[model samples]
Target chain A: MEFTLIKPLFGGFLLGLAALSLLFFNGRVAGVSGILGGFLSFKKHDTLWRFAFLAGLVTGGVLLLGTFPETLNFTLKSSPPAVMLAGLLVGIGTRIGSGCTSGHGVCGIGRLSQRSMIAVVVFLSSGIAAAVSIDLIFGGEI
Target chain B: MGLLMIFLSGVLFALGLGISGMTQPEKIVSFLNVVGEWDPSLIFVMLGASMTYLTGYGFILKRSKPILAESFSLPTRRDIDPPLVFGSLLFGLGWGLVGFCPGPALVALVTGYDSVLIFVLAMGFGMYFFEGIDSRFQRGVDGGAA
Candidate 1:
């Protein structure tokens, strides 16, 4: 297999393993949005673990930058304004929707949750539509 | 021990995202733009992840309780509510607009790009904004019923 394909597959396996470990040991879903949201809420006795996980996430990113800089290499396609808007939408949407790619797309689908199946389909289709629209608006710049 | 496992899980998850190319906004946009130059790499990522998770999840569910926690804390809501649909739609638009979801966006912060920082801050604001509105709305409804 090509390196491109192998890399993603291996990375995906790691993601699955991470989710599994969280569930097996901590009995919590490794949903990034949920973890962050809960931390922000300051629920009693609930902040420490979330902080630890987020700190670990940032640490992992630091490690990747140090060891395999190539993996973290990429450029932003959208302008600053567009990027900011996108971030806002993602934040609100994930909060109201109760999940994101990791939570719904990975764990939810793995467990055969019907709601997650619908969510994945909705997000994927809408995402495609939005990308196409942005491409057209930007004359293929985005 | 539970916290340790969760922290390690976060680390592994971030590493996976970095290695899988999910940290790349352009790649995610290209993946979403199926009509354009499509990169099918994300499909493999999801496939590998879901399959691995599904297989392991089956075994994990068989256990009466998690090793570190008293019981599993999984989501139980099954209704296909309006929030699920509309929120996902909005999220997709944002994701398609910038190709950065919550996890990869956070993972990409190590790059120290100004854009990533801006995006994350805005996202936090958005989440906080929604929580405020949602709580007020809920309170209003409760007051009316009472």
Candidate 2:
């Protein structure tokens, strides 16, 4: 019920627009893992757009930093090993799952894909479970 | 033209992540803390994105092809498989663990922090490793059962 939620709401709208733009223009799904993974492992002919997209993301970051530096005020809470393991898991898991939050939660759900729905459910469940378990065992926000 | 559009899309996506607080790992971690002081802002994020995209998708599907492409490249698989379930579960676990999915992690890479840099490198390695293993399994190089 807090007004702070407005920021995420507005940002979410932009994220959706971003996905819609890709769908409308390129006939592609704007899945971050898919884009980056393909860029890392796919053939050369399809790499250009992926590269350009990532470059654009970096450019956006620069623009945001220059305009509103206060948006990025949080810090990493996990340790080095935890971070590495999580990254590895996320990279492989997203590739195997065929999507992530953006792909499944936003685009897939918006398009009414059953597979994406199931994937989103699984993602939320596991995410909450891991978070709770970590908190219970680690006894803090790790 | 298509490439430029994709670039712009990425820009928008990153800006959205930044604005929505999705780029902040701790914010996400807080959201995951459902038993504690749960932050429901991420819920609004998904809601806002879903509504926006759903409306656009409704209109976009009316067309045969996209503006710059011949066909809509969408996921066609409808069946539920072990990989899909387990993979999503694993991805969610990782997301909970690190609070950095592929997109925000990329955005966070701009911070030039050692943690973000290391995570990105490891993630890249993980993706490459999956490709290597999957391809070998496809070709029966390591006797990997299909």
Candidate 1 structure quality by residue, lDDT tens digits, B33-140: 877888888898998888899999989989999998789888887778888888889989999998999999898999999989999999988877876887788721
iRMSD of prediction 1: 4.3
lDDT (tens digit, per residue) of candidate 2 on B1-146 = 77888899999999999999888877787788688678888899989998899999979878999998889877767777777788789889989997888888888777878898889988899888877887777731110100
Chain A TM-score for candidate 1 is: 0.93
Q: Candidate 1: which pairs clash?
A: none
Per-model TM-score of chain B: 0.91, 0.90
Query: Residue A87 error for model 2, in Å?
Result: 0.2
TM-score of 2: 0.94
Which candidate comes out best when scored by DockQ? 2
Which 10-residue window of candidate 1 chain B scores lowest in summed lDDT?
A: B137-146
Report the C-alpha displacement of residue B103, candidate 1, in angstroms.
Answer: 0.4
Query: What lDDT score is found at residue A70 in candidate 1?
Result: 83
Give per-residue CA lDDT, model 2, range A23-127, as digits (tens).
Answer: 899878888888887788777687898898889888888877887676666678788898899899898888788788888888888878888889889988898
Q: How well is candidate 2 docked (DockQ)?
A: 0.60
Interface RMSD of 2: 3.9
lDDT of 2: 0.82
Report lDDT (CA) for all predictions: 0.83, 0.82
